[model samples]
Target: MNSLSAPQPVPLAQAHRLLNHGPTVLVSSAHGKRRNIMAASWSMPLDFDPPKVAVVLDKATLTRELVDASGEFVLAVPCRAIAEQTLAAGSLSGRDGDKFAALEFETFPASRVAAPLPAGCIAWLECRVIDEPQVQHTYDLFLGEVLAAWADPAEFSDGRWHFSAEGRRSIHYVAGGQFFSTGEAFEVSVTG
Candidate 1:
């Protein structure tokens, strides 16, 4: 799929909605000639309006090294269609070889970051790291300011998600190779 046409721009203020549901994300990073992709379930929106996000990256991972050197990364929300690849990404180490090619994944360049956004994802967030050395060193946490965000028009638009098709819905990772696809949507009124 063509990444440019597949994803429509999501306003900075509404970008957090893309990650608010807390699905597993593929964090992509590149510094100099080395580039890598990894699956991460410990990622979430930390703020809105000049949106910010936090994700846990182990200190020893190549992703951590790249993000530390480049100060940028792309968080792509993968759907059920790529579940196997997603699992493999997190399972293998980029130190072994190019994970993307090894997993037979495709990608396109991101607008605001050097890391390429993996194709077939439901949404993408290009971010620049917000330095916090203490927390970074102690907790292996990285915080970023969202520079750009995009979503698949078929699954998301107007700050909402419509997962009507099979294998097209966002997924949440459990342990091992298991995952749960986002289910039905509903609403309730609360009068304050």
Candidate 2:
């Protein structure tokens, strides 16, 4: 709906924390005059230093094709607030038309990549693909170096999520169109 407020920049060292807990992400890519977004549940942080991330993109999907051509992408973590839209994105194919308008998603430019950042997502990671053609061909998995990262201030700051805003908590996907929001925070210590 509304564009994200001035998102706060997350330090490169802490960017891995964004996806550490496992949330479904909106994978956006742009090449030439076309851009597209798709929902993906199979993405994760692969490294800490230099901030690497791994995500699966289907060979048949336009988003994957775009990423292949552009060598860049943006993984925007959506929340319960836009669950319906996220599901719509996953269900729809991008070859027909503009998915952003079809899904009613608002987006803004990314500084280091052509991929636009979807609005309302709790966090955004702009990435450059690391050349890994063998794995990409065999498994459709992509490895990326996180170039820039951002988070919604009210929800995430100082490399941690403090979910105080409504419907802004990160979400996880279940099978058959079901999803779950992140639960309450808990902490534990060991002294043995």
Candidate 3:
């Protein structure tokens, strides 16, 4: 599959914009010869300046193992164009085989982490896992410090999303196979 557009760097201070609207993301990770990707809807930005994010990875998932071992992961925001593949990535188990090859997914190496950045995503966030074994084992929650961020120029630029093109918008998963495409744009002015 071809990328909708090339990814451009997003400032660390503005990295939260990519996830502010709450889109489902694919968490990709790798350690040595092991690599895996899984779709997650339970991810959110936890901080601003030193940008941090939190995501839930089930204990049984291969992604959890990879992230724990490597201390790194890449969060890729998949658009509507590759929604099916995104779901498939989450459903299959990497323990059986290489999910990327099995699902025909393509990826590129990230700059600051060993995790591979999945292709066809509108934005990518390379993260270094922040040690919090208590929450990790108890709640299946993992926190990461945003090391690098990138966005597809066509969908996001200047730290703002401009999804003017069809099938280029981000997606939010509901349940089962249902998902909602991010639609429309609006702004509210605050008067003091």
* Best by the lDDT measure: 2
- For model 2, residues 33-127, the per-residue Cα lDDT tens digits are 99999999999999999999999999999999999999999999998899999999999999989999898899988989999999989899999
Q: How high is each candidate's TM-score? A: 0.96, 0.97, 0.97
The C-alpha local distance difference test score for the whole of candidate 3 amounts to 0.92
- Candidate 3 at residue 7, lDDT? 85
Error of 1 at 126 (Å): 0.1
Off by over 4 Å in 3: none
Give candidate 1's error at residue 98 in angstroms.
0.5
Candidate 1 vs candidate 2, lDDT winner: 2
Q: What stretches of model 2 exceed 4 Å from their correct place?
A: 1-4
Q: How many residue pairs clash in each candidate?
A: 0, 0, 0
lDDT, each prediction: 0.92, 0.93, 0.92
For model 1, the superposed segments whose C-alpha errors exceed 4 Å read 2-5
Q: What is the C-alpha RMSD of each candidate to the true structure, in Å?
A: 1.4, 1.1, 1.0
